[model samples]
Target chain A: MSEQLTGADILIRALEHEDVEIIFGVPGGAILRAYDSLYDSSIRHVLARHEQGGGHMAAGYAHATGRVGVTFATSGPGATNLITPLADAYMDSIPVVAITGQVGSRSIGLDAFQEAHTWGISMPATKHNYLVTQVDEIASTIREAFHIASTGRPGPVLVDITKDALIGKAPWRGPGQLDLPGYKPSVKGHPRQVTSAIEMILGSQRPVLYAGGGIIRAGASEELLAFATQQNLPVVTTLMARGAIPDSNPLTLGMSGMHGTYTASTAMQRSDLLVTIGARFDDRVTGDPALFAPEAKVIHVDVDPAEIGKIRNADIPIVGDAKAVLGQLIEAGERALEGAPAPERSEWFSTIAAWQRDFPLAYDQQPDRPILQQYVIDELSKRTDADTIVIAGVGQHQMWASQFWGFEKPNTWINSGGLGTMGFAVPAAIGAQAGMPDTTVIAIDGDGCFQMTFQELITAAVEKIPVKIAVMNNANLGMVRQWQKIFYDNRYSATELSSSIPNIVMLAEALGCAGLRAESPEEVVPTIEKALAINDRPVVMEFVCDPDAMVFPMIKAGGSNDEILMGPEDL
Target chain B: MQHVISVTVENKPGVLARVSSMFARRDFNIHSLTVGPTEDPKRSRMTVVVDGPEMEQIVKQLYKLIHTLKVVEHVPGEAVEREIMLVRVNAEAQRRGEILDAATIFEAKAVDVGAQTITFEVVGEPSRLADFLEIMKTYGIVSLVKSGRIVLAKDTKSATKKQRKSA
Candidate 1:
C-alpha cells in the first residue's frame, strides 16, 4: 500500500489502473477537485459544452473501440443533463462509466447548492450506481463501476462522489479484488443448452440468423459470419447489428424493423426457425410479439438470462457470452452434422432472393426532383470505405444511411437504436474520431437531429478532431412528418423548423469548421468529397434533400409483420 | 400464479430500493415481501411473493440486481411457508366470551386488550391466517395487519414431516 492520497488522487489512480486513456467531461463546482487531479493525470480530457454531449461522446468512443468509455459531470443540473445519454446507453447495452460529483456529505439530503438526488434518479437509468461519501471507498466504488459497466450485458454505470470525499484522504491500495459475488457473467453456454440449440438449428429448414448489438458488444461478428456461411443460413441484422456480417455477403439480408428492407422483413416473417444470436426481440423489431414469426421456433443466445424470455419465448435458451456461445455452437453443430444429412434450404434462399430482386431497397430518385436523401447516402457510401466509421442520428437520415451504406465490417456503424435518442451523432462522431484518429468518422444526421446537438461542433473544432458532418437538410422532422401524414392525417404538429436560422454554412464558419452545401444531384459527390478532404478540423456539409421524403418498407408500429407496407401507396 | 422467491443480497445501503425499483419498473405486482438479517451478518434474505404469469422472469429480474447474491424459488408443493396476522376484534359484553372461544380454536394469543376490543396474534400458513381472520369477523374485526411471509424448502428426510400439511 502506498502513502495515503487524497480521494480525488485515488480516483484518478484507479482510472489509470483501468487503462483508461480519455475522459469526456465538462467541469463544474462540485467536480472541481476531481478536475484538478485529472489535470495532472495522463488521461486526456475532451471538454464538452454540455454534459449530455460528454456522455454521448463517451458512448461513441465505446461504440467505435469496443471498450468501456468514461465521462464526468458535476451534480444537480450537470448530472441531470447526462440522464439522456445514460438512458441511451442503458437501452442499447453500451458499456459506459459516468462519474458525477455530489454535494458535500453533510449536505446530502438537505438539497445543497449544486446537489441532486442523482443516486436515486440514476438507479433505473444505469446498470448500477454508487454514492460514496467515505474517502476510502472511492477506488473500490470506481473499480466496481467499471466492472459492472463492462461485464455481462454491458450498460452504463454511475458513480456519484461527494465533495467531502473528493477532498478527503485515502490510502492507495492498487486494484483490490472485487467483492462482487453476485455479478458473475456466464461466459460459456451450458453444454446441454448448447446441444439443444444445435439440435434446433439442425432440425430447421428455413432458418434465418437474427443478429443484434450484442454481437458487436461480444465481438462475435467473425463467429456470426463463419456460422452463417458454414450452415448456409440467411442472416438478417437489426439496426444495431448492421455490420455484424457484411452486407455484401450473398447470404446476408439487410436491416430489419420499422424501416427494414422488404426482403429482410418478409424472410423473418416466413422463416421456420429464427436463430437469434445476441439480439433482444424489441417490439420495434417484432411489430407484434403475438404475430411475429408465427411459424418460427426461436433459439435465443444471450449473455443476460433475463432477456431470454422477456419478449419472445425461446425454444432453446443459451445464456452465455455471444462469442463463447457461438464457438460452442459451431463445434456442437459440426459434430451433429458429421453423418446427418445437411438441411436443404435451396427453396428458402430462392424465395428470399425473389423478394430481394423485386423490392431491392428502391427509391424514387427522379432527375427532376430536388436532392434525394437516399441519393446523398449512396453517394457518401461510395465516397467512404470500410474503415470509415459512420454514426447516425435518429430519423429518416438514419434509416437512409443504414439502408444505403454497404457496411462490410463490424463496429463501422454506430447509432442510438433502442432509446432512439436524437442529436447523438455530433458529439458521438467527435468521440469516435478521437478514439480512431486515423479512421474517418462521419455523422449522417437529419436536419432536426443536427440542430439538437450541433453545438458540439465547437468541441470538435477545439479538439482538432476531424469528423465530417452530413446533415440531410429537409427542414422538417422527417420520420414524425411521415407518421403524421400516414396515421395522423397530416396534422403536422410543430414538426417543421425554419431553414434560414443560423444558416448551416455560417454556423459551421462561426464554430471554426468548413461548411459546404449540395442542392442538386450533380453537387452531391463534389460536396461530400470536399468535406472529406478537410482533415485538420471538423467539416459540416448540408445536403439539401426533399422535405417530402419518407422511409419506405415500414411495418406499422403495432401491426403484424405480415401487414408490412412497401411504400406510401400501401399505407 | 403466485411465486415465493427468496433472494440473498448484500447488506448495503439502498439495496432494498434497488430491488423494489426493479420490480416496479418491470411491472411486477408484489404480493408480500419480507427482508431481514440472514445467517451471514453481511447478507440479508428477502422473501418476495409476487403474482405473475412469468415466474422465471421475476426470478431473473431478482438475480439481475448487482447486490443480489443468490435467488431461490420455493415451488408450491416443495416448500413450507408461514405468516403472522394480528387482528383486533370488537368485543362487547355479550360477544367477549365468544371471541375468546374463537381465538382459542385458532391457537391465537390475546396480545392486547382495550376498553371494547381484544387484539389476538396468530401465526400459521398464509391460508390458515386468512381462515382465522374469517372466524374473527363474526365478532366484528376492528382492524387487522398481516406480516410478510417467510418460507423454507421442505427437508428430504422424513423425520420432521408434520402430520398436517399447509395449504
Candidate 2:
C-alpha cells in the first residue's frame, strides 16, 4: 500500500490531509518542483503579483475562516518579500504557514544563486520555522508547521525545504507523527486564580471588561458576552477585538484606546477593577503606561503567559485560553451571584453616559464640499449587512472604519491591528471572499495604502471574488499629514500622494472589474448601490474625500489618554 | 541585577538564533551565553546570563517560543556555576616558571607548551577566570578563549546514588 512519491507530492498530500482548500503564492525556480506537483493536486492555487500579497491573502483567509492560511514562495527575494506578511501575522497572532524552497542542500551556505538564509531571516518573524534537508521529513514538517501555526496564541510558521529534497523520491507515509517534546500550551485557568478574579469582579463597584484579539482567536465571543451580560459589566473591545461584543449591545462601551470612544476610554481610566481578557495592553491602547488604568486593580487573562504583566501589572493573572477562562469566570460569577446579590454600580453607568454624551465621535459635514472620509464609512456601515466582513488597511481610513462600522459578530471585522500594515486591505478582502464565497467582503482602504498592494486586485478580478473595495481617495497620506500638521507646525512633507495619481476608477476598469466613482455627497449612495449590485466580479468604488478630515480624540504618542484632544479646535 | 537562566530547547536549526535575537529585539543585554547539546540528542541546553531590570518577563517570553521546552532561573547562591577559559601566554624561558606557578596556584592545567608560549586551561567561576586572565595579561598573553558560564542547580539528593542503592 506504500506508494513512492516525490517530496513535493508528499507536501501536497499533507496539505490535503490538513484540509487546505487553497494556497496563494508565486512560483520561482527553486519552487518549480512543488508547483509541478500542485498542478495535479486538488488544492487550488491563487497566483499573486507579489509574495507579500500571497502571504497577506493567506492571513486574510485564515482570519475569515479561523483556519491555518497557507502560502508558498522560493528562496532569496521571494522569501524576503514574505517577511512583511509574516511579521504582520506574528503581530496580530494570525495562523499562517508559508512554505519556501531553498537552494540545494550542498549549496545552502556557499552563497549560491538565489540563495538567502530564509531560516535565519524568518526566525524572529515566525512563531517557529523548519529547514528540511531530507525528503522523508516533508510530511511531518508540513504537519508540524500547521499544528504550530494554529495552536495557542497562533502565529506564522515557515517551512523551507531544499530544492533537492523537493525533487527527491521518498516512501509515502501519509502524514507522519509530530514529535514535538517541548511545545506544551496550557488551556485551562487554575481554579484558585479563577475564583480570585471572580471575587474581585464581585467586590468592585465599577468594573470594565477590556477585550482584545484573543477573544476572536479563541472563539470566545459568546462566552465573553455571557459573562459580561450576567455580571452587568461594561465591555470595551480593543481594535483587534472589535466584534467580540456587538457594538449595539447595551453594555458595550465601544472600542477603547487612543482612537477609542471617549466613553470607553473614560470607563477604562475611571474603573475600580479592569478585567482584561485575551488583550495585550499595546502601546496604542495604553497611550502612556503610567497613566493607563491607574485607578483600577487589573485582572489579566490571556492564553500567553508572557502578556500578563508585559506592560501594566495585573493584580490577578490567569494564563489560559480565553474561552476556557471566560467559561470558568462565568461559572464562578453565577455561583457568587447565587450566594450574594450583584454589586450596584448605577453611578458608574451614569458617569459613562455623561461622558458619551459630552464627548461623542463627531465629524464636521460641509454640504457644498467634497465628502468626508468618515462620512463615507458611516454610510457604508449603515448600508451593509450585519454579517458583512469589513477589512481595512492602516491609517486614518482604518481608524474611521473601526469607529464607524457596527460589528455584530465575531470574525466579521478583520484588520492588521498590531502591525498597522498599509496595503493589507484589498488582498485580505480577496482572501476573505475566497474563504466565504457567499458573504460580502469590503476593503475600506486609503488612497496611499491602496496604491501599495493594489496589484492584487487583478487576482480578485480574475478569480471572480466579487469583493467590494471602497477607496477613500483623500489624495494624501492622511495619518502622517495629520501628524505633520499638529506636531510639525503644518509642515507637509512627503505624505502627499496627489501628484501624478492614476484614475482609480479607470484603473479598476482596466483591471477587468466594474469601476464607479463618487465625487459629491449625492453620488456616494448611488456608487455604493451600484457596486453592491454587481456580484459576478469585484468592484472598486472611489470616493473623493476631503483631504483635511482628520481622525479625532487624538492622544499624541507618549501622551496620556487623559490629555486627549477632541479636535483641531483643541489644538 | 544579573540573572542566569538555563533554557532547554529542541536541537533544531535556527533555534539559537531565535533565542539570541529575542534578547536583542527586547533590548536585553546578554552578559554571556553558552549553548551545547544535552544528554537527550534532540535537545540542547543554553545558559544565558542577562543583565536587566526585569528577568521574569524574559523568562516568560522564552517560554512562549515554540522551540523552547523549559526555562529555569538559577538562584545565585544555590547553583554551581563554572566557566572554562584557554589562555596562551607569551611564556619566554624566563617567564615560563612564573606562568606555571600562577596556573598551579589557580588549579589550571597546561595543555600545550611552545618555545615562546604556553596554553593553559582554567575552569572556575567567571570572576575567578577574569582574575586569572588579568594576571596572565601581565605575562603578555598570546591568545584567549573563554566559554560563557554554564550552571547546574544543586540538588538535595543525587539520582545516581539513589539508583545505585536501590540496585
> Each prediction's Cα RMSD?
3.3, 3.6
lDDT for model 1, on a 0 to 1 scale? 0.89
User: In candidate 1, what are the lDDT values of residues B67-138, reduced to their tens digit?
Assistant: 888777776767788999888989987888888888899899999999999999999999889898888877
What digit string (tens of lDDT, one per residue) describes model 1 on residues A1-571? 6698898999999999999999999999989999999989999999999999999999999999999899999999999999999999999999999999999999988979988999999999999999999999988888898988998899999999999999999789886458887788888888998888888887788899999889999999999988887677999999999999999999889988788998888899999999998899988788989999999999999998889889999999888899999999888878988955567688888899899888889776787779999898898898888889999999899998999999999999999999999999999998899999999999999889999999899999999998999999988999999999998999999999876765999899899899999888888889988988899989999988898878888889988988878877887
User: Lowest lDDT 10-mer window, candidate 2 chain A?
Assistant: A336-345
The list of candidate 2 runs beyond 4 A from truth reads A339-341, B88-100, B111-119, B134-143, B157-167
- Using TM-score as the measure, the top candidate is 1
Q: After superposition, how far is residue A372 of candidate 2 from its true place, in Å?
A: 0.6
Candidate 1's C-alpha runs over 4 A off are: A339-344, B157-167
Relative to the true structure, candidate 2 reaches a TM of 0.96
